[model samples]
Target: MASVALAGCGKSNDAAKPVAAAGAVEKPTLKLGFIKLTDMAPLAIAKEKGFFQEEGLNVTLEPQANWKVLLDGVAGGTLDGAHMLAGQPIAAAAGIGAKAKLIAPLSLDLNGNAITVSNKVWTAIAAKLPKGPDGKVAHPISAAALKGMPLKFGMVFPFSPHNYELRYWLAAGGIQPGFYLPGDLAGTTGAQMQISVTPPPQMPSTLEAGTIDGYSVGEPWNQAAVKKKIGVPVITDAEIFPDNPEKVFGMTEDFAKKNPKTVQALLRALIKAQQWLDAEGGKNRAEAVKILAKSQYVGADPEVIAASMTGKFTFAPGDAREAPGFNIFFDKFAGYPYYSDAVWFLTQMRRWGQIPTDKTDQWYADTAKAVYKPDLYLAAAKSLVDQGVIPAAAVPETDGYKAPQGGFIDGVTYDGKQPNAYLAKFTIGLKAGQTVTPAGVK
Candidate 1:
């Protein structure tokens, strides 16, 4: 089965010839799932650019109703894998939401999400916000600006970057986003502003209908709001936590074990797609946005998708800014599943009371190592490097933990090796002996 790469992808037909290296895989056919968000670009690119086919894979990309369905599809074997929240596998491994032995072999993307407020909310707080030198509202508008107002925000999933970023932004500005008791799934206990779950595609409409005053989600949904004039994105996830891990290519641990070769093929194809996405300084993004705008994929207008995908992000109708790193697929080691990245998500889960009890730093590290399979990822990456498909420097060399990182909006540094100490620094979350209750943090 021979196919040419998509136009503007800057690849020859020979690009797909690396599949022979994978040998005969145990499973050649795959059914992968994704939500309708822009960060799912690598999956679309893999299928559209025939990277999957090139890697001896017959892959079917299905759009799921929501994150839960996508997660269940993978855990239940309906989907071999999925474009999942980074926290999904970590949560699953920790028995938080759905208890299953899931693992993230590859990270899908970084920093493609943003927090948007309804036009009503924006209008109410716009004048109070300080302006930049460019005579526009200053960027990274603090959540403190909306502190006194009664607001309800939406996130795609409870264990999602959207939820944690929204909470981090709010808590940084001294507003309690709340805690999750063992039975309290709502996570609104002691919250100044209520945050709840709403599917990604419904976020814009939900804001327009005034059902929720604001939301945190991946693009082009946030950009869709700007296009529809329904809401304005105040801050991006990159602004909240720079180069933060967003989504991952996740499957059940059993599936990975049973299909090691097949998993390598999948990772190889996906890594190629990611490289193409960030190639030539994002020269392929226009075609990527066009592919994502199709009915079966993201199903949004090309203009809307391009609003965030093509080197710039639209905060409002006229408020576009250069954000070259917004939807990074492979650049800056985006595809590498760092154990420290896993540990960061685990820290947030514990900080929000999703774990419901204290966990030692070593427990966090062990849990992260169990869930994030860097060995598997490195195996695939090494193959690609051996084939000269990617640069040797593309793969990061580390002992799993990243150095102390400090780009958070709150100015607090995070070290994956110090989860408990990091949790104690937060003024709004559960501390070492603290636990969540029906009343509040106890």
Candidate 2:
């Protein structure tokens, strides 16, 4: 992380003031929450590297016990803002987990998550894996080969994109990714399907102890397994979804309404942090890894974090290989938060039954409008372009990235404008306007 001095920020009326309401004042202090995962690097990089201070904002980075705690903190005003799962803001806005208007004006980074399988499970699947003409394991190692025995797959949480990403990869490979029934919120006891949730850092141990056959989680846990020689990374989300949105820097709706300018300024600092990370052909990655490995932060080894952060991936011990863009931070088209990214999460939420009722495509649009504020993000980008922090042409059309997003490896086109039509394309899960009134669902 870059060095930053945390000092009290005084409000400035001349800073373009976002396109929000007039005369919005800067926040006096910001209490930001994050779980210990590498995807939150932008936040850590902002604070440790002084990007926050450069924005004339005084910010405190707090670590929460888990995603739920971090979210509750933000919702209850215990936290001013936090790093969150890409789906958290959408889920909250759509009334899935906790009802609220959650806005992510900035996307932290992308492609940092990977699916890991235990050594035993890896061998079991690899044995049946069809070898390529070059004698290499073929892409998308499937679960159809391991169906003979029962196995518990793990996810970070049911509401987590980690869960959906894992589920998506499994289903794509001809395996059943279990969906929790509506209001079945307690735990996943009997998931006969291929994937489920385990906390990210614990993913390695859970697989090692045979509690689960495999898991999908963010670094450095996936790489940690390779460091420990306990498991092999099966596939990355980058492969499954292709630059799929992984994490976002989220703020509560109340915060946005009350402190819109503060939100934009905060976004400005985060965007700068991202550009720094991607600068100089990613030469700053080693410094970023040192910060993530601090005992108070991710607390993983620098080399382990590097395995993914620096674009090198290790599936198993002594099995390290070059996998560039494995963990993107501070660069690429990584900073802009897209509305279509919001729609994808909504589609997955509905697919897995977290979204109980059938919603129309218009409803999807309205819900997306309520969160994923690219308008605010554009304000920051404009500011960066003016400040010479970023080039203007590098910005993708912020109008929307969802237009027939057919580039998914599965060849399914997802146009956020027609979510219901997109939902119907899936062979699995309840389609639009469809409901599974499972057992006691009311």
Candidate 3:
């Protein structure tokens, strides 16, 4: 338990009036881990705004070097919980990387990523792009613009949304982003464009050095590229898949089972933080940028952080556009852990050959239910509603599955109930009953 005590609280406050009742918390002090990304805003906001203290929790928000380190810290108990990728808990639960029984009780936000191409690659693609009457490249530029170009792209992790979104975008354009075969984890078996792993912070420099032609990553890295005159953001993930689930607040199942009350309290505070972040048409976004720019937090320049956080993403140096829902936190029921979101990620994993065997649609549903604990999310939401912290309508009433959504750039409808059928609709990715080897898909 390596923990730094947050200011304004100490051991002396342990005797102060508790939120629920004295001795209600099984664990009072906690350390949560996060990577240096803007999507980790809820955790930062919660800690900074005393939401955690209001719930009788003493939280220390620790910034990990990267997503892998952050996930491992939560698994090993070094961190009580973490701001995790939507796929991390699913991948770990399926024994993909560092196997652990991690559960995501809350979804952090929706759609905070963009695909950025290096200046050279952008220049080439821009030449082919059709301009509108305003003399700017069309919004939601298709991946087809970069077709036939020999390029290498980078993502933050193997099982990250960045990889899947980028792959989906390329494949939609008839470009093979590649597959992950067993014993060959490089993920470039039959790729038209080679894909590699690069830390989020290093994406701009890596692109500048011509190591990777483009990259799909979350903010403020994408915004950082435009600020540095190294890359141009072609499209946001919201364009690829509207309101796509990005990150989740994940914890080891054991921790949740052991500290039920504490987990509830933590969720309560986080929900409030999310509401605040998305409140008033983003009135507090500027203040959030300042907090996230702190040395101990995201540690990025405030201007770069504000580029996307303030509802206007800088696609190019002077091409800023209005993107109100760019970084949705609490609106549209963003905090609720929808199982359909988990099933969608699993479909991508299977589509990319991460799951080396065929699975039933029921398997997808069961796995999603196991990792995405919407029951717990509802409980937390109910608690908040009881306390009048949030409106009842803010929490959706359902069986944990969202209605069939058809916002994918490829124009394919993902029902979540028919994963294999949805997967078979893709002409690029591995289909059902197909397995990938070092040689190729067999």
Give TM-scores for every candidate, taking all chains together and pairing residue i with residue i: 0.96, 0.89, 0.95
* 59 Cα displacement, candidate 2 (Å): 1.5
Total colliding residue pairs, candidate 1: 0
- The parts of candidate 1 lying over 4 Å away from their true place are 1-18, 21-23
In terms of lDDT, which candidate is strongest?
1
**How well does candidate 1 match the true structure in TM-score terms?**
0.96
What Cα-based lDDT does every candidate model obtain? Answer: 0.89, 0.74, 0.88
Arrange candidates by lDDT, descending.
1, 3, 2
The C-alpha local distance difference test score for the whole of candidate 1 amounts to 0.89
Q: What is the lDDT, from 0 to 100, of the residue 91 in candidate 2?
A: 86
Q: What lDDT score is found at residue 168 in candidate 1?
A: 95
lDDT score of residue 22 within candidate 1: 53
Of the two candidates 2 and 3, the one with more favorable TM-score, higher being better, is: 3
When summed lDDT is taken over every stretch of 10 residues in candidate 3, the lowest stretch is 1-10
1 or 2, greater by lDDT? 1
Model 3: per-residue Cα lDDT over 1-442, one tens digit each: 0111122221122343446666778998999999899999999888887778778888999988888898889999999999999999988766686678999999999999999998888877787788888999987789998888999999999989999999999999889888888776978898889998898888989999989999999999999999999999999999999999999999999999999999998998888788878777887788899999998889999999999999798998789999988999989999999888999999999999898888999999899888899888889889778777777878898888889999889899999888899999999989877998778888
Off by over 4 Å in 2: 1-25, 186-191, 194-196, 330-332, 439-442
Candidates 2 and 3, the one with greater lDDT = 3
Worst-scoring 10-residue span by lDDT in model 2: 2-11
TM-score (C-alpha) between model 3 and the true structure: 0.95
